[model samples]
Target: MRYARFTGLISVLVANAIPGTALGQSVRIVPDLTTNSIVVFQGVDETAHFYYVPLEMDFVRAADGKPRLGVQYFKEGDGDSWRVAVSTSIKPAASDSELAALKAKLPKDNNVTLSPLVLDFASSYVRFSEAKKPTIFSLESGTLSAGSSIAMKFEFTGTHDAVLQALAASGPEVGVMAIITPDASLVQGEELVFSGAAVADLFEKEKFLLLNSFDESNAVVAFIINGNHSAEAAARSWLKSKLGSPEIGKDDKGVWRYGWDLTRPELLADLRSSPKISLPTFSNVEPPNKALLLPFGNICKDYPDNIVNLETGTAGCN
Candidate 1:
């Protein structure tokens, strides 16, 4: 009865259904190479709206060629608070002794270590109006063996408002699912690989100071700016002078984020002309472009005076 604590309020019955199969929802698995994780998002019928579940898994191969799965779960707390409820690793047990050792290292009453873990949605789905009582959702992790599959069953209840609010508060989880193999077929969306040499060339030609760059995927790249306040100000001003005012916001950790998605045809054309950097060409899909500015150690609301809009170059406080 781990999930029984919040069951006294309402009784609604809802079953976790797969997206796009009679149900009006669809699931998308997006791979993020920057963090080495895959993100599963549940969307509603080809719309731009989607919400990721709180469950995330990271899979990596050990030196012994065995697959190691890292699982993390986030639970909603009181008044815009969220905390990690479970953070554990799972791997195949080769022998009885190994299994015993693994169990000894795990939490005393952790249901995740148990075979065929049943993830009852008593608390998670209670807030959803469409959810039903006594839901029988289960996440079956049969065996951690390679080539074996794990099945997850859970419904996204509520009007997506709750889900969106929770995500906006807690931030999106960045990890992959254990069920998908590393060599799985590429999902929808064209993959674009950034050329490190080309990026270096842009810096060499004084396009912009390439402090550091991370190729998030074949399609996206994130650049880290200088950490100092003065340097950050200068970089922000330069970006604004070049790219126009960027979309500014703060992450869950309160760190300021300046983002730009250059998927627009005009923006792409502008970038190609000015930066002169090599852009990926596709026969069917348009190339993806994104730029993110992260000033290390600078938290939001702390440096209001230093904040300036990139577009107007006005020294304004955020």
Candidate 2:
């Protein structure tokens, strides 16, 4: 019973994401109190980076409900590896007397040692039961049928052996998600109520959509950062060293400006060629500070299939 309770907790906080809502284009942005409006720095060539900063007082639980302090990062581009993150508790010694006690106050676990970000992963067996190759097909945009739903026919692409095995297996299963930004005329916070063992979960639902059972999280927040070339890469190389979240440099503080070229053809061409946008880095950036972290929750409950925030704009696109 304890184990079952633990697993239930694990399911909530692990931070799982289905590609449907978005990894690159459509993700959530929760600003901190220090923030007002976010400057999107729009252009094309430079790279995009994201950071997941956690507060020591705030505890992010696992899907099974284990308490932890962690976040994720997403590099915007076509890369497979990025960074996972962890933050160590800090101790201060402003005075000689306090310095004397520093050693004792410091966390004993070497796991708290300051270092570059590390790889944090979500398990497959817990979320996915077996293997089945993904088959691709184009839909007619008309009456969707059962064995005829548009989801069952997409070619799953990847060289991983485990992924390869899953594609060929029969029975109920899930795969990459397909998310559509509905026309803005619809009200905010109304999602389709749907579910399935596989893509079929969403095959014929004519309502706002919900996160699939296979998906671990109903909402996702991704931060993708990248550099175009060596010069920009050089200025921003430190950014990579500090992917998850950087301490505000206790001694010398600075915004530390660094950006990558956004126009490098060779770097993005590979990504542009594919219909799918691949996000390499996903970090648990700012927490869901009541206002930001969950602004969309109530609305999300209303517009389960929606990807747009209504308050930010005047609706008339229809």
Candidate 3:
């Protein structure tokens, strides 16, 4: 009746399309935004290679005045992991009683709950093969989170702001959204190397040591660009100046990475036109040249002897 368990390899492409398709009448709506939810991807082929990871968090309005991006679910804890800081200068957006009065000034945690996320595309799922549509899909009214649940009936031809305005007219140069909070005074053998706009000007000059009163829900922000490949293509034309064409990937230890999701508007006006310390300051920024730790997962395996290069992802500074 309800199944939200979906694990890897698109679940063997939905169990090999369940013995010759006949369930998915054609489910579409692919604007993954890394996993802000809205990916009923089983086919009707817009380009299928389908695989996903963003687990629900769609709010929109990431440009034009900046700050209106939702669905950043990052729950994991003990040493650390939490999420919730969607106040990027609030205005017309930010309801739900203004994000519950800004999550009541943060730092209380009854085991975390930021609230404001709402995606229930009838329990979303997406594991497509060929043949037809064996089963396992459901999406009728978005606003459901707690991802991976199996349900059926996905044929959303358009909407979700028209597939994010057709993926912002197929262009992506988005850069620097770094907001990586967590530093329990970080000294378990310290390591926070720098390169290319030095961690976005060290989050705009030590953003109060990456704050998190009790729940920023394991704060996360992307636009990660590690080096080699012309210093990750010169840190993507020095933080998105060229725009679009950035699919580079390889983080589970194999260095060399690249990421996006600023939602392109001249790449968010070239990352809000200056202020990542007015860019350029890489005196060989280190670790394959100007690194910012992106050797992949476990946030670079929780710093296993930093100076990155988990099999060539490069970084060093003993």
Candidate 4:
């Protein structure tokens, strides 16, 4: 894994303390809902350094089902160039006090705050530029047989400049976003629906998309589909169609999953098989689980995980 090489680089960046010119640096943490990973951008003026820290174990979940971390540091990478490194032996703090103590070691003046922005793949749409007034192609509608070459746009927030920068710098490539389907919605035979209205509702409530940058607001994102497989199977099939057949197998919990083995160049060529626009990062998230931890490192000891509110620290669970 490319991220395996940056283990020491992360320690030097996080533990050695921010440089004396710390005022010029900006640290923003955003939850990538698609991958269930925390994406941190250490922005310095126009250029930014990126880090992707996965919540592998002992993490909390927000009301909206987003994963929250308690001072975690594990993976580091350059989003612009697509080089990643992760620590293998690192783990989350065992207790709240220990987590706090670990946090205290950070640079005193450092402003490490979470960003309201997030990247979601639950419902995705692509806008075609061939028409006078761009038409939308919804991935949920099924396979797009619009020939081999097609042009389209994927909408995203302007606040995601760092992510956009990374994608733009990487040039043409297939960008994959993990699809997180709720257990309740997992009907075996029924097809799942992801509509633009749902995305609009989410944006209206959270203001997740802030169209500040004209250049970064929208990018060419491809969501190709074919055949009549179930939603989950369709997702896997889409990847397989683009990146070739994946390693089909079961996980430790016996749940089936698809794994792909290809170099960066090969993956990019396969994704760009058709003359289409491409994004940089690509991955998926697993299904939801019970016994989720709180953002403050408190475990919920009851059912209906959504009832426990992080703001008031109330709702019965202790």
Of models 2 and 4, which has the larger lDDT? 4
What would the per-residue lDDT of candidate 1 be over residues 188-269, giving only the tens digit for each residue? 3222233333434443343222223212211222231212222233334434444554565555589665554334445445
Note the Cα lDDT for every prediction shown: 0.28, 0.22, 0.27, 0.27
Q: What is the lDDT of residue 162 in candidate 3?
A: 31
TM-score to native of every candidate shown? 0.15, 0.12, 0.15, 0.17
Backbone clash count, each prediction separately: 8, 67, 29, 7
lDDT accuracy of residue 224 in candidate 3:
31
CA RMSD of all predictions? 29.3, 32.1, 30.9, 30.2
- Model 2 TM: 0.12
Which prediction has the highest lDDT against the true structure? 1
Give the poorly placed runs of model 1, Cα more than 4 Å off: 1-24, 29-49, 53-318
The superposed Cα distance between candidate 3 and the true structure at residue 55, in angstroms, equals: 9.2
User: Which number leads on TM-score?
Assistant: 4
lDDT of 4 by residue, 1-318 (tens): 011111011111232133342322333322232133332333324123333332222323447644332111111243322221111111121344533443444345545431111112232232222232433323321211111111122322212233222223222211211232121211112222333233233323432112221122212111111122223334444434544544555555896655443334554444445443221122233423212111221222222232232324454222
Clashing pairs in 4: 3-84, 3-85, 3-86, 60-293, 143-225, 176-282, 178-284
How much is 20 displaced in model 3, in angstroms? 49
Compose the digit string of candidate 2's lDDT tens values, residues 1-318.
000010000001111222122212222221321123221111011112121211111122348643332122222246443221222111100233432343244346543221111112111111134443433333222221111112122223222333323322223232222222111111111111111121121222211122131122211110111221212322133223322232222212553323322223443343335333222222222212211110111211332222221323322111
Candidate 1, after superposition: displacement of residue 175 in Å? 20
Order of candidate numbers by TM-score, starting with the best: 4, 3, 1, 2
User: What's the TM for model 1?
Assistant: 0.15
Query: Candidate 2 at residue 120, lDDT?
Result: 20
lDDT of 3: 0.27
